[model samples]
Target: MPYPFRLNAVASLFVAIAPGAFAAEPDQIPQDMNVVIVSGSRVEHTSFDFPAAIDVVDASRIQDSQMRVNVSEALSAVPGLVAQNRQNYAQDLQISSRGFGARSAFGVRGIRLISDGVPATMPDGQGQPSAFNLDMAERIEVLRGPFSALYGNHSGGVIQLFTRDGQGRPTLEVNTAAGSDGQRKLDVNAQGSSAGIGYVLDVSRFETDGYRDHSAATRDQGFVKLTTAPTAGGKLTFTANSLEQDGTQDPLGTTWATYQANPRANEIDSTDTQSPKRTIADRYNTRKDISHKQAGLAYDQQFGDDRLHVMVYGGNRQVKQFQAFSKFLQVSPSQSGGVIDFDRDFYGADINYAFVRPLGDGKLTTTVGLEYGHSTDDRSGYENFIGNTFGQEGALRRDEQDKLKTMDPYAQAEWQVGQWVLTGGVRRTKLTVGVNDAFLSNGNDSGGVSFSHTTPVLGALYKINPLLNVYASAARGFETPTLNELFYSGSGAGFNFGLRAAESTHLEVGVKAIVMTNTRVNAALFQVRTSDELVVDTAIGGRTSYKNASATLRQGGELSVDTKLGAGFSGRVAVTVLRAVYDEAFGKVTTGSRLPGVPNANAFAEVAWKDKSERIGAALEAIASSNVYADDANADIPAPGYAILNARFNARQTWQGWNFKEFVRINNLLGRQYVGSVIVGDANKRYYEGAPGRNWMAGIGANYAF
Candidate 1:
């Protein structure tokens, strides 16, 4: 089928399943309309009245009958959001929102990440989703489109996880899970409240022998949270968490030929004259070790109709990694070697005050705030071979001290009167980056650069009736190059300070409505225009250099429908259609070239059933995505589009003060061979990351309350 026709068909299917297709049933209205969200405006408000696209994944959807290891397992149900488990733990999950962050080779960029009112993204706009503790998450809120600009820098979108607070009776819980390919997990947790103070503690360990060859990993994590109310209208919270991983093997991507021959096979090292069968990963022992620890404190006070909030946090991270670069590549004097070692220390704070009052015939709420963040990294690089023996660190080639700092001051106001709601906000941000080169034999690359921008957003909503709302929003945002993006120029020179930050304009129109009493629907149309957009100039042996492109355009539509289908059954569907392309030609990339790593269309659907007591349940899900390109020129063979089916069953029982639950899940029921993700712009043409054909997992949990 033609791409345009296929896209239109998907859009038509979404409309057919949405609420507008059915007649309204006022008497059977569901209570979900009362759900409250705390994103976009930083205040409690129903999503139905908000002038933006926002979705919430509740605790049940995140934990029930799931591995609860990777956030991608739950985020797939959100439209306009693409989350993939690369099956290579060393590299982390690949997540992108509305075509943004799709070109990232490792970790996450372009989007903002937050946990428990603390920023997870660094001041340089890079983030690690692996830092989130899924077991303790109460809910995750996703905000997209123009309203996302309110968060300041690199705000392509916003994802925030809120942890559950300890309350009620003291409880102790234990959970264990085992899955295909030697995957296993064990977790223990305790929570209670005493003397007006609440506390929660959690510990977990996970090990996997990976679905692909030469991939294995183990992870240990610990978390603690404490809460107290010291005065009449004052509350304080403290949270701490740590994650550790040692010797996690990295299975680099494979070429199309290798993937077709054997989906689980690693790339062979043709240059290894002594061992013809050895793979590049095995030759260099590509692996990573990581240690991360963080702590945060938050205080909130209420002064009648006004409120004040303050948060402070600090963290440290250490990483050592070995890449599969051949020894011959390091002969260049300017080369940074193949082994990377870095230790980072970061700290940040946020303070905000909100005032509520009456203006004219409407109620007005205003917020003013300041945010500051800083980070320093001690980094060094070395060759991955010693005396002709591969897999050993040798001969330091680079050393440096890198620092980043950011400050932002912003204000926002919202007014509501009768059937009209209006909102406006502005933020001014300044970011500074400095580098001190210690290994100067290659040349002194020490330098500093600063970037500043002022972003403004405006939104308006009209309530056509109690059941329907239409809104529009517009904003201006910007994203600066991360520390890693500044490491090398297109010509392999050090410290590319000449690179400029990308600026963007966003516009969106959306609708939220309840048509049939038990059915709710949300749809949005959005467009983004960017200048000085970043693109990969060259990528070799895990080292990538970036350059700015002329202009780019991204336009898309998202639709989501949720409904209770009666008789103990429910159904949900989410669909997205996006067109991302370069608006002007640059170098070898032509004007109409599609953005690499982004699919033109994708969708998810699910149907579930439960018994009256909610003690037994079952569900079936379908997921699909369109083909994706691997480079700016679209010259290589694209990853083929695919659809997969999954099924799960769960049971629960209660005895005395103890509750027990067990679940079993099977994914890729048809045993299909497909690429789960891609490494964009790989110089070696090793872009395909294969997904597992068929897999199964089972877990059991017991909780006792006293």
Candidate 2:
């Protein structure tokens, strides 16, 4: 994801500028407030330096919200993006920007996700980065479009997460929360520093009976970070974060007939949860379990006017799943003891360097970095009840695993003039892929390798004033074919290494304005052109092959207004509009076909009031959206549009009016019906009917501090 461009022309034209002699006065930074920024982009520093889009959400926005899970959940209210919960109790979700709403194979679409300045994506460029602790995060910065060259490949927009750190005296915190649908959450976080060493440890265990049948999910997450500053010249940081999850298996997308037969149960909802007769007649229950671990180390050094940073990180994940009843409809039923196991591991290193030099007129900043990593997978599919015992076709030994390794090198530079900011970056990539298929007659494994073009971007930021900024930029991004996409030839002609990489070009323009001392407005418009975009061929049904489309275009804009209401009452509102199209005459698709899965718009608004004296707080919010389609053809089968409203009220108090505090919260103030996921395959293959209707609960919680 290196962003390279023709900066010589811009630098040539920007030479005639003033010296240390500048015009603007000191930045009117909010005295006590913090500005969480997406690192790499100067957009966080000033709006005028880049003609692109960048968003910063402060800590207050998070603490007052009712979101659980990951950053996407917390950002569900943000404009320009859509967050969808699959409701399987797996911390399952889908978040997309521009025109990529329903494309949830792995996770977010064309968006680069980062945590604590480290890359949070799979080597194949497709996979969900597990949600770290949202409560411990200080702020989140989101940059939209291809111009986000600072971080390489999958260079779609970028999200940078920053965790809270030691501010002063050492402290310890403990909290617990529980609500309806058998929900409960317990958290403990502590921070302290001694002997030039600082540390933060956050741990949480959360569980829920779920809003629906077969929807139960539970997870335990913990992270410990240690930072040491040996001398005024150097700092070292070591971090270890781990997560364990187990619950109901994957939810099967069902049809209206299946739903009408049993509205409360899932395609695999367990009858065991009920009575003998009830379980004997019901066949809608299913279940799944998974675990993941991650750890890393980083170092930073400061030498006078420059700073140096280097980091190496990696992780491993495993999943165990079971499904039934569906076997009655598919190739075979996973009845009895039918189950599957999947395990994966990844470890890589990110090395980078940055320096600043003073020139005659102004200053020049340059950066170059190289990233190399290896990711491997060993999967064995075993059916506890394989063979005729379960009336299934696959054997007990049926299983598959894939191994892949990739190397990428990237570089970038930023030049500052009187009032203009110019920048560029680029990266080259090479990959090798191998697959182990139990059913294949070829060999134990099959392999293929290839090299690809670099992802690149260029941008400019123009600061009109201390409170006004405008920017624009263009970037090129590419994603290599994944293992399944390259070698897993399914029922039809399985794998095709012949498939090309998914590529994209993003163009953007936007402005940031501080309306007043207490309010701010940020907005941006973007259009992305993508070629060889991966799309499943449904015409043949179950047969998978990728076709390189001529080119698909997606355009959209986002607007957000944040205001400090003063007192303890504050609010914010945001809206987004997106459109996608692909005018290609291929397969069943004729010319002028709109892209499928992408939504037209997403909107959210919230209001909250807090009273420490009264020991009370309440918040009300709404998330609404338009319809979605199964295909660009816009046919009869479609996902309808829906809206949801949520309200929360919490009261806090002290025991002796000092030592400890307790609080209670009421969630799901209004219950509503909806659908969260729509997968491809069978005509009836659909995950339907969201959280059950009309259920409420209240829980008393306490927090201890030392």
lDDT of each: 0.90, 0.61
- Per-model TM-score, in order, reads 0.96, 0.85
Q: Candidate 2 lDDT (Cα, whole model)?
A: 0.61
Kindly list the per-residue Cα lDDT of model 1 for residues 122-147, writing each as its tens digit. Answer: 99999888888888889999999999
lDDT score at residue 573, model 2, on the 0-100 scale: 81
Poorest 10 consecutive residues by lDDT, candidate 2: 12-21
**Number of backbone collisions per candidate, in order?**
0, 42
lDDT digits (tens) for residues 1-706 of candidate 2:
1111234422332232211113323355354322534355432344324556666666655554333355555777667766666655543666665664345443554567777755667666655556556767777777667656545555565676777765345667766666667878877778877667788888888888776565777888898788888669888888778878875434445554555465455543323343434321123334556777877788877777566778888888787655443333355343222445668888888776777887657777776777776777776554434433332324454456677777878777777887767777777777767666665643454546674667777888776665566677788777666654564333334456567777777777666655545556666667777787777643221112444555677777677766768677867788887777674666666665666666677788877788857477777777777766656455535566667776766666775323333443343346555555554323334434454555444444444434
